[model samples]
Target chain A: MLTLAQAQTIMSAALAHAGTAGFKPLAIAILDSRGAQKLFAAQDGTSLKRGEIALGKAHGAVAMGLGSRALHKVALERPYFVDAATHAVGGSLVPVPGGVLIRDASGALLGAIGISGDTSDNDEAAAVAGIAAAGLVSDTGA
Target chain B: MLTLAQAQTIMSAALAHAGTAGFKPLAIAILDSRGAQKLFAAQDGTSLKRGEIALGKAHGAVAMGLGSRALHKVALERPYFVDAATHAVGGSLVPVPGGVLIRDASGALLGAIGISGDTSDNDEAAAVAGIAAAGLVSDTGA
Candidate 1:
């Protein structure tokens, strides 16, 4: 189970990584296995909407059980599916690179992390850093 | 004004208070003055619905410019108003006792906080504790 402590750890690591890498202020969202928000934070100076956008990406990743990068690829071929997915949840499911699913060492789905603020690639990098820092697996862009 | 650091401090204090009080697992939501979510978290073992419900209560408190307790009173006096409120916001408002408006020392509305997963009274207690811990005011019930 993704405990709140673990979620906070992941967020801290992600923010630390972003800071060390000199990325812009970012927001991070973590959702549990059931796609409910476990923890979320928006760094000071991030856009006002960063928190919500980060949550949408995390929710989308958890809903699909895959990284948003994969969905981005799918969006290229089937954009309508992306739109339908967003409409179904009444949220903006950003099919971008920053949403990544988390898993245990044995590959059990735990939850997901979404990062936003800098470039999508940088955001994804920070998320991966956080997942690794927490000793969890990122089942995206493997 | 509410900053991200203050929001984190509030969540930490709320969770600690809940743990000490031995309340059920909880979900907390904090929203900025603009009705944007600033922070959110769900403790381990909380039902998946907790986060959403907490968010709804917070949103409702913000929309009505009062605490959930007041809204609850209003709900009792005017059921139709509650129904309209729930419908008008696409089902985000929850007129319950777990939501509390947050204010600065100057009596400025900073945001609102919501708690769910325990009895309404317990939830309100935790929210109030957190707000006080952050040196903010909960302009409801005190």
Candidate 2:
């Protein structure tokens, strides 16, 4: 079973890296395997809208069992499915910046990570740092 | 005015602490002026069940002009009102844990923060770090 401690480590590392770089980041979200919220952080000065974007993106990643970027690939591969899903879910499948799927050492369904601030790539980079710091890795199928 | 930088800081600190102590967690949420979600992070192993709770709590906090704890107090004060609101809004008022209103130095509603992990207090503490780190303070409602 994936522990919350591991998730927290991943998130903290990301935030530290982002600070060092001086990025205009806002929120960070970490979800457990069952798609339940495991950890969350919201710094001051962040834009208000960031919360939803972060949740939607992270939720999408966890539910799909893949990173948002990889999920986006599936969307690209099957636009009809992606469009249908997004419409059906009422703006749930937001393939924007700041979303990624995290796994445990055994490649278990630990949860997902989503960030909102600056660009999508920047947010993703910070998230990656968090995961790496936790001694885990993120995968985005190319 | 709250920026994204603070949000990131708060969440990162929370995760670091949580990880060191060891706990299960959920994604963190950050909202902005319009009560819209702007930033988010999903830990690698958060459960899916807690996702809705985190979102609802934060949403309720932002929708109302009170901290979630204050809203909880009001809920106890007027169960009928909170219940009616819950039913009318499809059970959006989650008063369990991990929700706080974001305010400026002058006590203006900048947005809100929501977390799900460990316990309500644990979640709140993590969010607190992000808020304080971001150079903002949360109105804990005393």
Poorly placed runs, candidate 1 (over 4 Å): none
Best by lDDT: 1
Q: What is the per-candidate TM-score for chain B?
A: 0.96, 0.85
Q: Which portions of model 2 show Cα errors greater than 4 Å?
A: A43-45, A87-90, A96-98, B1-62, B66-80, B87-90, B95-142
What i-RMS does each candidate reach, in Å? 1.2, 5.4
Residue B105 miss distance in model 2 (angstroms):
7.9
For residues B1-142, write the lDDT of model 1, one tens digit per residue: 5788899888889989999999999999998887788889888888868788999889998887989998888889999999998898778988879899999998999999999999999999999999999999996533
What 10-residue stretch in candidate 2 chain B is worst by lDDT? B1-10
Looking at candidate 1, what is the lDDT of residue B81? 91
Over A1-142, each residue of candidate 2 has an lDDT whose tens digit, in order, gives: 4466787688679889888989885577776656555666666666656656776778778767778887667776888887787776667665764677787687876678887776888888888888889888685433
Model 2, span B1-142: residue lDDT tens: 4465655566677667667767685567666666555556666555555566777777777766566777677778998887787777667667654687777678777777787767877877777766776677786543
Per DockQ, the best of the predicted structures is 1
RMSD of each: 1.6, 5.4
What's the residue-level lDDT of B98 in candidate 1?
A: 87
> How well does candidate 1 match the true structure in TM-score terms?
0.95
